[model samples]
Target: MTVNEPTNHQDLAEAPAATGEVADLLAMLAKQRHFLRFTTRDLTDEQAGLVPTASELCLGGLIKHVASVERGWAAFILEGPSSMPDFTKMTEADFARRADEFKMLPGETLAGVLAEYADVARRTDELVAKLPDLSVSHPLPKAPWFEAGAQWSARRVLMHIVAETAQHAGHADIIRESLDGAKSMG
Candidate 1:
């Protein structure tokens, strides 16, 4: 099927019904998540971990990183920036641990990472639906990347999640093409 085809295999994984802006946001997120997930289709654990490009990102690593990012941002919606690590104060060890999120360390299976991603996605969808107000926001935590005194509503955070997922899905597409001939998009 072409990219324009509705209900392709990649998009078969979907959340329940939502409406209006919430529906629009969730739909975009699911599409990107599916594209990222699609890149790993039929890949072996070793293949998933192989970095075929100059970039360190492997298909499985991309999955792990995206899932970690989404989970943290989803928590931020409810718990605010405090739910995230203090990126400013992280030590070398902490930095190293964060980097490991991109690797399929020994015994880490493709199936396992994908399963974790699915769980995280489900929880994020549920959180968005149950939240009373998308306008509710929190001050961004101190970080080099985040602007000072900036606050983001739940809706804004969700948009960030969608952007992150799409960016990484593009990375995953490249990685997958390098690993094999498969393409998530034509």
Candidate 2:
């Protein structure tokens, strides 16, 4: 049989709605990303950037943070722990730069941040699909939050991405509610 052709009738059958573990993960991540992005609908850059509640989170900033985090984790899956920084040696500037990821800076439009997030999401979805083995794993980098010497599989990383997106979507929902009584979930 040629490489492009399926060898069996089963392979020729129509695929299920989410045919595999990776597909399931991608589906979940997409739902969360949609919820997160929905919060910013009809918002101006000023509204997107406003810290409407007691906390420092803004709708645009939350989207930016989620996109940055997802991009980093997706890279970690392919490039291993080396794709991430050694949190132990993080400098003030590193922290500052991280903090900046949460703010819609001057001249920064909400549309721009959303576009970047969409791009990141697309890249991550492609990576998850193209990876050969979801079970492949790597040692986690030294970080205060991670257990020492711990390792995580590609599956785990994707799950973490889903969790992060969901958490931030909730945060965005709250921020949106505070800003204008809009509820993402009602």
Which residue pairs collide, candidate 1? none
Q: Which lDDT tens digits does candidate 2 get at residues 68-129?
A: 99999999999999999999999999999999989999988887888788778878887788
TM-scores for every predicted model: 0.93, 0.90
Every candidate's lDDT: 0.87, 0.84
Check candidate 2 and list the clashing pairs.
none
| Total clashes for model 1 | 0
Q: In candidate 2, where is summed lDDT lowest over 10 consecutive residues?
A: 6-15
Off by over 4 Å in 2: 1-18
lDDT (C-alpha) at residue 173 in model 1: 88
Please give the TM-score that candidate 1 achieves against the real structure.
0.93
lDDT of candidate 2?
A: 0.84
Give the per-residue lDDT digits (tens) of candidate 1, residues 21-134.
899999999888888888888888999999999988888888899999999999899999889998899999999988898888999998888889988998899889777789
lDDT of 2 at 40: 82
